[model samples]
Target: MKSPIRIILLILGFIMLLSEGFMGLPFLGGTYILSLGWAPLGSNITMYFVMFLITILDRSNESRSSLSTIAAVDIFANMIAFIPFVGMFLHWLMFFLMLVYIGIVLNTREYRGNTTHYDRHRAGETVREYK
Candidate 1:
């Protein structure tokens, strides 16, 4: 994946992390959304659908196979996120997992060989010989 796209995903992950905290606030105040209705479950399912779409898109970028795998796992994690305690822990775990995945993506280079003339010169190769 491109650097800009990876950065955008990192930003989105942070936003989701923040939203996760906010979602817990009601629970602390004794206002359970789960008790109110099935809205929370419905929203979680909707989010899973959206994440599935993202996973499909990520899969199209052949260079980032690991990213697609991580995204796919994230979809399943979110699917079970409506469960009382397990769901909450999974959400937090997935957020951190995503951060790690983004770090890996950012650190990876698409082309490992040196492309600059200076690098070739330092390697004792004639710069003019490069195509």
Candidate 2:
């Protein structure tokens, strides 16, 4: 996504988080009653939104592929959390996957090389270049 759009979404997500917290506040110590449960779901969506932003913003080949893979799996898993009787398990799985994603992001390197497919005519030259 464009920087402008990403900025807008980031701002919106922050607002959503703050408002969700405010809405979940309870009066006179009835904290348990203030559980709206929507905040978590909204935050999940916002996380995915951020993922989408990353996918478009980053130009590195390896990074883009990794982010896209994680985002696809995560968003689907989050959606699967709506399934009957398995919602909690699915959510936990998704959360675990999120940690794995973070690790990948932290360690992945930006691949910098000529990405053009090798042609028969250039095969001889390509071998000398990399070797």
Candidate 3:
């Protein structure tokens, strides 16, 4: 993924993390919207489903693939959520979570070489090369 996209994903992740905390606050409109019956349940179900999708995506690649797949999934899911009855809020939330997941995947460290080390002093400065 490009650096700019990764940075944007990180920013979105931070926003989602914040929103996740306030999801229960009555002052935040979602709480009221959630109280109106089926929407809340539907939103919860959608969130879990999307989370599962993200997990599957994560497991499919050992390294960050590209921004294309992530962007496609996000945009497609958001479009599906736009249906008036289904509401796009939950889909947006999942999109944000996926952004976070992608950011995490991008930031993870990958070992490029052997990490084990042996002390030269203990071996009296003898130099040995292992192939």
- What would the TM-score be for candidate 2 when compared with the true structure? 0.50
The TM-score measured for candidate 3 stands at 0.34
Summed backbone clashes in each candidate are 0, 0, 0
For model 3, the superposed segments whose C-alpha errors exceed 4 Å read 1-8, 16-62, 66-68, 88-96, 99-103, 110-131
| Model 2 agreement with the true structure over 26-107: per-residue lDDT tens digits | 3411232225443455556667767666675666535567656766765666555444335445554555555655555545
TM per candidate: 0.54, 0.50, 0.34
Model 3 pairs whose backbones collide: none
Ranking 1 against 3 by TM-score, winner? 1
Q: What's the CA error at residue 3 for candidate 2, in Å?
A: 16
RMSD of 3: 10.7
Question: Of 1 and 3, which scores higher on lDDT?
Answer: 1
Q: Which portions of model 2 show Cα errors greater than 4 Å?
A: 1-34, 110-131
lDDT tens digits, residue span 43-131, model 3: 54454444434434543334444433454454444445434434445445654655556566576554334567877756554447432
- RMSD per candidate (Å) reads 6.7, 9.3, 10.7
Q: Go through the candidates in order and give each one's C-alpha lDDT.
A: 0.56, 0.53, 0.48
- Under the 3 Å rule for N, CA and C atoms, how many clashes does model 3 have? 0
Give model 2's clash tally. Answer: 0
